[model samples]
Target: MNILYIVGEFPKLSQTFILNQITGLIDAGHHVTVLAKKSESNHKIHEDVSKYHLLDHVIYYDENGRDSKFFKGLTFIKSIFSFGYSQLLHKNHPIHLSWKVLLSSPNLILLYNRLKKEPLLDIDVVHAHFGPNGLLAHRLIQMGLIRGQLFTTFHGYDMLRFIKQKGDDVYTDLFQSKTVLLPISNFWKRKLEGMGANPARTIVHHMGIDVDKFEYHPIKMSQDIKIMSIARFVEKKGLIYGIQAVSKLIKKGYNITYSMIGGGPLEKEFRSMISNEGLEDHIRLLGWKTQEQVIEIMKESHVVLLPSVTSHDGDMEGIPVILMEAMAMGKIVVSTYHSGIPELIEHGVNGFLVEERNVDELVHTLADIFSLEDSISISKQARETVLNQYNIDKLNRRLIDTFERKTH
Candidate 1:
């Protein structure tokens, strides 16, 4: 099957889940063409991006005219000439697009230009990664610029924070037009249903980690504990709380080292807070490591800590893939019972889960893991959880089957 993946950023360091899906599908004998709004940061990308040569199959467009309007106009005119005005205009257009939808054409003028040269009308599925991308794809389909069964996956911010800001009706058109709605967690599957998504069309499909890539090694008890977090420095991550918890533990005379991987808007503020708290020596903020680097870090660390919490604006995590990766690596994980995290982590079973912002509880959980005799057993259970449920190859095959069934 030929699938076109619509996304906000192509080959992003943070969105390895999407990349995994793309490459997984390709490996499973499907053609995937990526359509991204923009190429993301220059930070080192996942090795799979190069290994799979994914950039070759990508089509990029400017979101807000970071490129000149004159160039876009030229591209649009060129597309019209190449495809012929009648074909591009669609003489018997399938849907009646609104003025607002027509207005969004310029953002996709470059894509239209590519379509003129190599039209994707034969594509079986047009799957968008987020709500906004789904809306964009809906507009294109409405304009008769693309022809495929539409599907959208609603991840954390797109459904929670975005809808909170844009209102419940934000996804009304997409919900009505899309053939399927995939939410990464049951938490979000309910949210989509509440926001008017058809219950029949919605499916809870988790973003999975490639368990094979993350080689599992039983965690060993050590005097000097190494705690690590691999997440964007954002409000919802509650990284500041992690820092505070680590500081409290240090003051209480725990021999521990904390390492933070990934970078975001809150980096400067986090750095300042770490300096002010005099934890520069104990906590290391290593910004934006590649996928390979992260796996290596996970292998060395005793416990993975992700103190995720609901941000002020209601942004939250939808079961972070990093936790899945750590669990797959047979590392004990300590995260919060926020959003869909509890679904992945069972408190005192496979892994430990504390309340959202309870630093003391987080400290206690970390301390317990350090001293517990059955730490290795718990870590093995963590790996078992990932292998049983969150395995990428299995999830991707399920996704492909769903796509085939829905499109047919």
Candidate 2:
């Protein structure tokens, strides 16, 4: 099958879940072409990105002149001359598109040109990873610029934060169209339905990790516990709560070393909190690392801490892939009961969970984990959970089956 993947950023280090699916499809003998407005100019990328030669199949479109009205007019005129007026003025190609589409994609002419060129023909499934990209791709398909059965995957921000900012009717047209809606979890499926997505078409499709890459390590008793967190320093991550819990554990005289990976807006704030609590010696902020580096760190660490919470602005998580990755590797994951996390983690069963932003509970959970003489059974269960459900190879086959079923 020929697949077209529409995304905001290409080759992003954090969104390895999407990359896993793309590479999995290619490994299964399906051709995939990635379309993005701009490329991610990162120095480090996941190994599979280069291993699969994914950059060779990537096509970038222009996002240069969407803000200014004068520039928009110039691009519109340029598009007419470059691609001919007949295609632009087609019945499905509305001259007066929604303000959002027109404003965001003023250079649609550039996208049409790139997609129509060689090596991008016969799109069987248009798999868009976010709401905005789906919206844009829906417009292109309507204009007869691309051909496929549109399928949009709603990951966190697109359903929660985006709807809060754009209102409930933001996806009305796309939902009403033949686009099949896929939310990463039941939590998101309900939210999408509440916001007017067709219940019959909306399905829960989780993002998965490459389980084979993360080797399981048995829990070994140690006096000094090594904990780690890999997340952007954002409000929804509730990273500050994790930091406070770590500090309290230190105060109780539990030898701990917490290493935080990734960087974002709240770095300075977290640094200040660490200094105020005198936890600078215990907690270290080790910025962004490549996928290989993260896996190596996970092998050394005993606990994976991710305390997620609903941000003040209505932002939430869509069942973080890091949690699944940790579970797949037989690590004791300590997260929260936020969003779709409970769907993935059953407290005291496969992994542990606490209330969102509860510092005391987090500290208690850590202490309990440390007190346990043997956690090998729970670790085994954690590894089994992901092996059965969150494995990328299995999920990709399921995704392809859905695509075939829908397209036929």
Candidate 3:
């Protein structure tokens, strides 16, 4: 099958889950094209990205003659006149006349021109990663640019912050169209329904990790506790609470070294917190590492800590793929009972869970995680959970089946 994926950015370090799906589809012998607003330059790109030669399949609007301001101005004028002529003939859909499409004409014009140059015009399926992209895809289809079965996955920010900014009726036209809404978790599924998405059309589809790649290695007891967090330094990640909890443990004289991998907008705030607590030695903020590098760090660590909470701006997580990766590697994980995390972690069963932002509870859980007699058992169960439910191989097959089914 030929598939087109529309995303905000390409080859992003923080969103490896999307990369996993793209590579998995390619491995399954499907043609996959990526349409991204822009490409990102990262210190280390994922190996699968290079192995699959994804860059060759990527399309950006700024490419070709669209890069020149003068050319863009001409294109914009042409789009306005063309749209005006279509309106005079009553040949365009209501969406073509909407303010959203009019204001987005510059991007739409460039994207349409870029897509026209592609070898394939009619795509089998167009799977957009976020809600805003879905809206864009809807508009594109309405303008007769691409033909496909539309599917959109609503991940965190689009459901929370985007909805807050655009109001609940933001997806009204999209929800009315023949678009399937796939929220990454039941948590976000509920949010989609709340925003008036057809319950019948909305399905809870999770972003999964490649369990086989993450070889399971049971954790062993150690004196110097090594904990790692693989997340952006953002408020929703509850990283500040993790820092505070680690600092409290250090004050209690626990032999602990916390290593945080990944960087984001709140890096300065988190660094300030680390410094104010005098935890320079105990905590290390290691910025963005490659997938192989991250796996190596996971091997050295005993536990993975991700204390997630709803940010002030209402940003949340949709079952972090990093948590699944750590669990698949048979490492003990301690995270907060927030969003769809509880669906992945059964407290005191496979992994430990504490209330969001409860530093006392987080500290106590960390203090006991090392000395627990069933640490190995918990680690084993964690791997089992991932292998059974969150395996990418299985999830990808299910995704393909859904994509193949004809949408009403």
- The backbone clash count of each candidate, in order, is 0, 0, 0
Q: Candidate 2, which segments miss by more than 4 Å at Cα?
A: 63-100, 104-121
TM-score leader: 3
lDDT per residue for candidate 2 within 214-327, as digits (tens), equals 999756748989999999999999899999999999999999999999999999999999999988888999999998899999898989999999999989999999999999
Full-model lDDT for every candidate:
0.84, 0.86, 0.85
Model 1 / residue 375 / CA error / Å: 0.7
Model 3, residue 331: distance off in Å is 0.8
lDDT ranking, best first: 2, 3, 1
In candidate 1 the C-alpha lDDT for residue 163 amounts to 80
- Model 3 off-target regions past 4 Å? 63-78, 82-95, 104-106, 116-120
Query: What TM-scores do the predictions have?
Result: 0.91, 0.92, 0.93
- Write model 1 residue lDDT over 146-187, tens digit each, in one string: 779998898889987778766778788777765699999999
* lDDT tens readout by residue for model 3, 1-408: 889999977878888889999988998999999988877756578888888899999987664434566876788777667556656346445434554555544666767656645534568999999998898788788766777999999888998898888788888999999899999999888888887899989988889998878989766868898999988878899988998998888888888999999998999998888888888889999999988999999998999999999999889988999999999999999998899999999998899999998999999998888787768778889999998899999999989989988543
Q: Per-candidate RMSD vs. true structure? A: 3.2, 2.6, 2.6
* lDDT at position 102, candidate 3: 55
- For candidate 1, give the lDDT: 0.84
